[model samples]
Target: MSKIRITKEFSFEMAHALRNYDGPCRNIHGHSYKLFVTIIGEPKQDDADPKNGMLMDFGALKKLVNTEIVDKYDHSVVVYKNDERLPEMQKLFENIIIEAKQPTCENLVSDFASTINTRLPDNLSVFSIKLYETATSYAEWYASDNPTE
Candidate 1:
């Protein structure tokens, strides 16, 4: 069977701040984020299978991404885990994500890719991810650009 690529789009609200940057983004800010995930795989070949002719069910993908990314990050404030302000921020905000890396769009997209890659069914693989921090700006990650060893 020929390989096929399927994509799904998701949106969420999130806030973040760069710890030591010398720009407006250094302060806490938020964006209505848009995320697109693409998966590549061969459709199920068994005609008797309910999922036959499908690479993967859209609902399954939605549940996976929602559980791993969307549901957790939506309406949440994300900051570097080691940010000095973390202690104070935790006290003030109930929904905070202490990420290991800076919560920039670039890093977030890469993190999303890693998450999907690890959790996807064995027959499917993440092909790419594009994350939009603004209507006019976005970052993308492609599996082809970072082949696993």
Candidate 2:
């Protein structure tokens, strides 16, 4: 009857350029992005259940995170739809992805969280998502932080 949360750390490399920004960041650049994905669930009550007493198996969590986020975006360039470089970059990269909004650290984390939410099992809920753009700069989203939105 009690809720438990589990988090796993994952890192991937990605390049992105902000749209309409008059700064060095407007140019394409890459970062070794670190992500922490957390999920919440209640321990299974049935002792005979395969996942009894655990929120989720670690292997299951790893597989979900890798397939949903890491494998898709790692080593790919993320460009905003309106970015001027989108056209030129598309022709250059062997792999690239376009986002509807500027791919800032905050936006990237939000995207991960939203996509991760859809991939989770019905019994689990996303508790929080944290993304670190650099050693010091990062963003986080917590389900409890927002209400009546």
Candidate 3:
């Protein structure tokens, strides 16, 4: 079986702080983030049609991430752990959701990748998530099956 991999990029704005950091990162700040999501898997076996043999539909994948993840954080503030301001912010807008843990680029990528992997079909594997906090800085988290190694 032949395997296929696809990557998609999306961008959104969010605010967060580095928890327990003594440096400048400890201060609240925001970034216009860019995300790259990579999915990989063997082509489906039953579909004789060229298009049908694809591991997954790009449009559907885009829709899934856009609806479930991207839309939730776009233009929103992502805080580290819990802060007293969270409830106040939630009242002002419907966008705030408490993260299970500290909010950092690494955790954000991991969380989003894990959530997406769980929602996808078993045949499709979410290989990696790269989140760019700035044009020069980014973080990447990979699953065990990632071909990039």
- Candidate 2: the clashing residue pairs are none
Residues 47-122, model 1: lDDT tens digits = 8999999999999999999999999999999999878998999998899999999999999999999999999999
Decide which is better by TM-score, 1 or 3: 1
**Relative to the unseen true structure, what is the Cα RMSD of model 1?**
0.9
Q: Where does candidate 1 clash, by residue pair?
A: none
What TM-score fits each model? 0.97, 0.94, 0.83
True-vs-predicted CA distance for residue 112, candidate 2, Å? 1.0
Considering every candidate listed, which one attains the maximal lDDT?
1
Q: How well is each residue in 53-140 modelled by candidate 2, as lDDT tens digits? A: 8888888888999998999999999998888778899889978888898899988887788888888889987899999989889999
Per-residue alpha-carbon lDDT of candidate 3 for residues 35-129, written as tens digits (9 for 90 to 100): 99999898766766766677777888899889878899887767654565666666765555577688878788888898898788988878888
True-structure RMSD, every candidate = 0.9, 1.4, 3.3
* lDDT of every model, 2 decimals: 0.94, 0.87, 0.80
Clashing pairs in 3: none
Model 1 has a clash total of 0
Which candidate model has the greater TM-score, 1 or 2? 1
Model 2 residue 64 lDDT score: 93
